[model samples]
Target: MQVEIGSNFWTYSLCEGRERKLWWESEEYSKIFLKSGRNAFKAICNYISADKRKVLFPAYHCGTESEPWYESDWEVEYYPIENNFTVDANKLKQCIIKAKPAVLVIQSYYGFDALNDECNALLQECRNKGIIIIEDITQSILSDIRHQAVDYYIASLRKFFAIPDGGVLISRQPIAIRKIAQGDNNIPLNAMQAYSLKREYFETKNKGIKEEFRAAYVVLNELISVNDNNYAMSDVSLKIWNSFDFTYIAQKRRENYRTLSEGLAKIDYLAITRTFDNDTTVPLFLPVLVKNNTLRQELQAFLAEKDIYCPIIWKKSPRIVDCPKETSAIYERILCFPIDQRYDKEDMLRIFNTVEKWNV
Candidate 1:
């Protein structure tokens, strides 16, 4: 079998599922389900029309997360993050004071808890100053670290699950919203059709299906990039979300991550970016930092030849004016190893063995 370890989710077949309450279904928050994460962020920016329209973001990011801000014409500033992707509370406090941003957006990368006691205290101070806190839980969605004190939370559910299109916006207090409406375009429809083709390609290994499926992704990307309006999630995608067995999914991912960590412990050319608590973190992927950029790219190509795919999480964009040197280096050297629920310990071992062979 070809070991396709990363990339888009395949089509999911509906099955009997477990009954449980989602993390955001609490009575304390009013929620809206959107077609994608970008829409959720756009809605929040529209809702919170701050006097200055200034917002703060972390320097280490995928670069696309700030699009809604720019689309809405908000002034954006970034605060530096440590090498391990954690925020320094003192530095964060200093940035807030200097920037005087009306809004602060924070994220916990790869399902690990980024906020400690000191960070939480700093956020409380920001709230006291009437700064709105928006936690981007895209990576930390299913993890145990849910920050309720934040004024708002936004996440893309499709990132964590096999849904075609799903994003959510949650506010601490009840907020009046217009009735949910679909976008005038067909991005969701295109995505579902693309995923369905991907599933067929997986089953038949047909070259034509492969070409069509790949091309569909490119078209879908263009559609998503230009889609700025807020839209509701499709009925089919929401049904898939409702039918997921989240508990089992979390358990399998944790096991796979632990297995990979154990197997790669002796490798010298690379290291896992951050340590995560097994009890709390259901990591989205195992982030590995290579010693340099050239070696990282070579290793990525070597693994791809063996059918074990890994991804360089992101490239730094020129629009980010203030990223520190260390953070920029991370963008060049960091790679994400697949540890999702779809693969088991054996799959992780394949990744480790492949990397080990390439290292020599």
Candidate 2:
């Protein structure tokens, strides 16, 4: 059995052979596929032609999600997000009143509820003021608590699935933008190479294949960074995305998250970021807020040594808006455990056992 966890996807061979209906097809929203979520956000900016339109984004973000706004010359402001990973509704309301932004971008971190009761009320307040709400569902793609107040929904699919390149823009109203030219093939080509090499590494347990896989993965990321050309989702990726069984995928993620949560509770060195809500959330990852910054680094290295890799949710991105101390502290201490469809209870237990060893 493959022991590696949390990294670029290995080659995907499983396909649900029957004709399948995509989840988004049931929704009324007109959808457009893009090369990346950054490009999707850029499409929205291109659609909204206005003079000096202001936008409000959460302070705690991956940085790329909010870049299109700054690039489009929109006046940007940040609202506070509590350390508990919920929006500070009162402060956000105050920001909305003060800034009167033309657009508001909010995210439900790690597949948690995008808005609680109070935040929902704040969303209504924004709607009343004619603020265009953009919900970044990149972290919460499977989440059920989709707020209807949102004017645009955007997400990067690369985080969840094995797709080489994909991002989607969804809106209830018709979305019109200039035709996107076909993207360069290097990004997807390198991505497929990395996945194939990773699969071979697992089968043969070859150290060289693993190193080559990492190198290819690095090159893939670098290619994306330099190439910001807006492009439509490739037919190859679209077909792969359609073949998957999302129902089973979502169920597996929830189960794995519960198992990890139960196991992590007994460890004092780290704590799960928030309680899992079984009803609404299909968790993207089981995020843990490690107590000590130094311990967090140690834990990540320890896991990597055992072929279990946990990703830091966001590094200190230079583009991150200035947030309060609480948000900053959360960023410094946060780490994401793998709880995706690729693993079952045995894999989750493997992670717990390895972590228990390091807890000593």
Q: Estimate each model's TM-score.
A: 0.93, 0.93
Give model 1 RMSD, 1 decimal: 2.1
Candidate 2 weakest lDDT stretch, 10 residues = 13-22
Model 1 Cα lDDT, one tens digit per residue, 80-198:
77767788898888889889999999998888887788999889888888999999999988888877559999888877777767788998788655655774347667777888988
In order, the Cα lDDT scores of the candidates are 0.81, 0.81
Q: For model 2, what is the alpha-carbon lDDT of residue 287?
A: 87
Alpha-carbon RMSD of each model: 2.1, 2.0
Residue pairs in clash, model 1: none
Task: Give the CA lDDT, 0 to 100, for residue 348 in model 1.
Answer: 89
Task: Give a tens-digit lDDT track for model 2, residues 1-360.
Answer: 355888888655446453544445556779998878888988897788655499888888877877777887888788877877888778888888888888899998888874678988778877887878898888888677678777889989888888877889988888887878686577678878988898888888888787899999899777665535678876667766677777777888899999989998889988776886455677888988898788899999999999999999887557655767778887899999999998999999999999998844
Q: Model 2, stretches more than 4 Å misplaced?
A: 13-23
